[model samples]
Target: MIIAVVDGMGGGIGSQIVSSLRDELPSYVEIYALGTNSIATSAMMKSHANKGATGENAICVSSKKANVIIGPMSIVIPNSMMGEVTCRMSEAISDSEALKILLPLIPEDFELVGLENKPLILLIKDAVKLMKKEFNIK
Candidate 1:
C-alpha cells in the first residue's frame, strides 16, 4: 500500500509519522510523504518513507496517488490556519480515492521533555493500529 503523510513547515509531525510507521509496519507497505515545505519532506524521508516530496504540487500529486492519507484533521479544511494548507491540497486529498486517518489532538502539549511534541507518539500508535485494521497489515 502507498500511504501519504502531509505536513507543513518544520515537518516535525510528518517525520515522526513516517519513522514510526517504517519501524513498526511490515515491509509490504510504502510511505510516500508530501511536505508543504522542504524541511517537512526531508524530515519524513529521514524517517524512512520510500519517497517524499515538498511544496504545493507535491501535496496534490501525493494525495491522489496514495492509498491512504494521514494527518491532522485540520488539513481537510482549506483556508485553515492562515493557509498553511491550501485549498488545492485539501481538495486533492478529500476528493481523492484515499482513505484518511485524522487525529484531532492539539499540536500543543504534544512534547516529550523539551522535544517537539510527544502527544504525536500516541497518535502515531493509534494511527498504526488503525492502519493495521484498515489495511489488514497483519
Candidate 2:
C-alpha cells in the first residue's frame, strides 16, 4: 500500500513519526515522504521512506491513488506555525479521499513538543499502531 508521510519545517515531528512507522511497518509497505522542504524529506528519507518530495504538489498530489496518509493531526490545522502547512495544503489532503492517521497531540502551544521527544513519539507510536490494527493493516 502507498502511504504518504507528510511533514513541514524539516519534519521534526515528521521524522519521529517516521521512526515509529519504521519500527512498526515492514519494508514491503510503500512509504512516501511529503515534506514542505527538502530537509523534512531528507529526515524522513533517513527513516527509510521509499520516495521523498517537497512543495505544494506534496498536498495537491492524488491520495485516491494511495492507500493512506499519515501525519500529525495538526497537518489539518490551517496556518499553523509548527509548519508552513498552509490552508491549500490541508485542503489538498482533505480532498485526497484516503484514510488518514492523525495524531491529536497539539503540543501545548501548537508548536513542536519541545525536548520531550520520547513521550511525543510514544504517543504517536501507540495511536498510529492502534489505528493501523483497527484498520487491519497487519
Winner by TM-score = 1
TM-score of 1: 0.85
Model 1 misplaced regions, further than 4 Å: 105-118
Residue ranges of candidate 2 with Cα displaced over 4 Å:
107-118
* Count of backbone collisions within predicted model 1: 4
Query: What tens digits encode model 2's per-residue C-alpha lDDT throughout 22-122?
Result: 77877787888888778888998998888888877765674555577888776777776455788888888887878877766554566654435456767
lDDT of 2: 0.75
Local distance difference test scores for all models:
0.80, 0.75
**Cα lDDT for residue 58, candidate 1:** 83
- TM-scores for all predictions: 0.85, 0.80
lDDT of 1 by residue, 53-72 (tens): 88778888878888899987
**What does the lDDT come to for candidate 1?**
0.80
